[model samples]
Target: MKNVIEDVTCAGCCCVCDHIQVTTDGQQIIDVQTTCPQGQAWFAQSRQTEKQQPLIKGIDASREAAIARAAGLIQEAQSPLLCGMGQSAVDAQRAAISLADLTGATIDSGASAATRALQQVGEANCTLGEVRSRADLIIYWNAENLRFNAHHQQSLVPPGEPVPRKIVTVGSELPGDSRGVDLSLTVSVEDEFEILWRLRALLKGVALEGTTAGELASLAALMQQSSYIVIFFGPASPDERLFHRKLEALSLLAREIQAERRCHTINVPAAGATKGAEPVLAWQTGYAAAVNFAAGYPRFSPCEYSTVKMLEQGEADLCLLIGEDPLTGLSDQAIQRLQQIPLIHVGPVPLVDLQPEVYIPTGISGIHAAGSLYRFDGTPLPLRALISTQQASEAEILNQIETLLKPVMHIC
Candidate 1:
């Protein structure tokens, strides 16, 4: 019998488009509707693909047997690095954190720069619903971030908004559709930081020397005139060179404007399974990522404990890689370093040009397993299991791994 599920959530990107509809034949997904191309690939390809088995150093092995070897590696290593939670469920992320805490490993996700900036000044954040319903002024900071979510433009900046929405784009690189922009302030990445700094000065009625854009003043005027404003920003450039500094500047500027009138700064998520990652990490370790638990207490250090730093230095003897995402998180240098270390990978997606000491292929949460994911707006959403599969879910595999190490680690 064919089964139809309504209100299914898409796990493609951080947008967490929850209005998707799926049609299944009890064992495999037949159709998916009301979602974008990313969702289509996420739902359909997950089920249509071939299954993978557990491996121990290029040889296939039972999960139970592989767990023992993996536990031995954990036991033998002096310094261990636990990384990647991009594609894992919320429960899985918590489990990974627990494992890291028990094993005294340095845990990090590849994408923690924004989290680092937010930790410094804190985010002026709000829901996507609020942006769509109320915001009179919507500014896309980098605009390139919009490519991650196909529905954002239509969902947040739809036409026929009760009042005409004044659209503004900052930075030289804009998204594909530049039709309705009220003002497009084209500035180089180097000058972008100064633009936001000047805006903050204008907001405070403080004058700064050596002005760049007359358009900066006009953008400030729009902010003061508008009833509510929302700034949507993403990675500054492909390399994300000065991303952290730029983000800190943006946060400070938004805080200044928010003092008088309503303002929110929302981050457009990168294309990754890392939604709700920061929230979960913060709840568990009191820090988002780049956390070191080797002292048996969570230590927050962006420079010292980040995965890139650890990998680049080849400081870790054993690496526990959990889950995968399309883009964002691990960089080329980090991946090269990870290759040098003994790795135990547990998740649905496979790594390219890399094999692990232990590989346990698990189910995708929204595809073959039931779990919870988050939207970019920090909204919680449920992921429904759409089809039957042979493999275990990510949460279960993580728990199993944690169980094996607990006895050896001797944590009460």
Candidate 2:
């Protein structure tokens, strides 16, 4: 039995739950406490594998061999793409940035493209802190539930005295539990288009064309009642562009509402961290087009250089995966291309069919590793390590890789 039982923090997901507890027997971990299944699986080794799994070209290899091969691939490739920097330590991320500079490669995080767009929108918008503190109306569109991703979302509601706030869910159903909310309105997910159309019509003084008069009246009543509003949209599907268009329409509606009453609006997409970080990074740097441009001058275009398209066309030869779980989240086509290429992965092993050519597992950012992580509100939090372990830290590995790659690229 272990003498010391400690409450450890979990930063595996966006929720950043700090109530995790664990007990270790000497060097081996024995028990975990207060953690959800996701957290437990993330920290515990479930498989009956005695040794750390290492593979190359669908075959097993020693850690040294894997590292050497990965380095060689990067040295040879002309346009190596250093992608997915969100999950790794800040040091690893910086190392990736350095690698990109040395290799003249494209370095980007997951949602690099979407973040570009969000940054543009954010320049004209208020910070999330301001919204949470001030906004009275909280509207969620196409967001099935927040309990999974952002469990603490419910706590955003002001407790104790009844502050006049309206919580309207513009999706299929209302939340099963609405303790602190004053209003819980539901809209149909099937006729989302009609809902938007009705909202737009009401805002523009245009004639409505729908048979659901009662529903329309109810929506109108909520709209009129709201004083300060904030909309949250989930990017569960690939129809993000369409969702953005709908959000713009919603924003227009908010503007019209603001003409008579004070109001604000925004959409919190799935990649919340990048959403907060990208705009500033872009403004400080430039659009990704400029950042990733290989030619003499910087270029900018939305449709041109997305990761999905780049990988789909079989254009990428060398891939340096940073923070994302490519095996699960990415499209199958993209995954196929990734499998074909010389892939170098750094960070936590994603729960998916990786079969990576070189997988150098790094310390978990914001938890096992110390670094800066951007909160949903654009606030940068400096995460410090609460405990130390045997694993080689991400920052050290990144430094080593960068050093090894320097002479190969003739960039000291």
TM-score winner among the candidates? 1
Tens-digit lDDT track of model 1 for 1-412: 8899998888777778777789998888888886477678887667533467789998989978888888888888888988778767888888888888888988886556787788889888899888888989989877555633557676775446475689888877665666778887878887878788888887777765554547777888889899889998765455565688888998898888878888898877554444646778888888887889999899988787877778777888888888864225556887787778898888787666788898888888888888898777788889888888888877888788788888878943
- Candidate 2 regions with alpha-carbon error over 4 angstroms: 1-9, 18-35, 45-54, 58-64, 119-133, 147-150, 157-162, 172-198, 211-217, 239-243, 250-284, 288-293, 296-300
Q: How many Å off is the CA of 293 in candidate 2?
A: 4.2
Candidate 2 local lDDT, 1-412, one digit each (tens): 4734444555455544445666665445567674366667655642222234445665776656766777888888877776665445445655665666666666544454444544344322455555556667766665544423444464364455445666666556665766655544465544665576687676555656556655666666776777766666655354333444454545556666777766665445454333322433354346532145455333344344445656777766888776546433356787788878778876556326666677765555544557765544444556655334444556676677777887767752
- Best candidate, lDDT-wise? 1
Q: In angstroms, give how far residue 291 of model 2 lies from its true place.
A: 5.0
**Superposition TM-score, candidate 1 onto the true structure:** 0.93
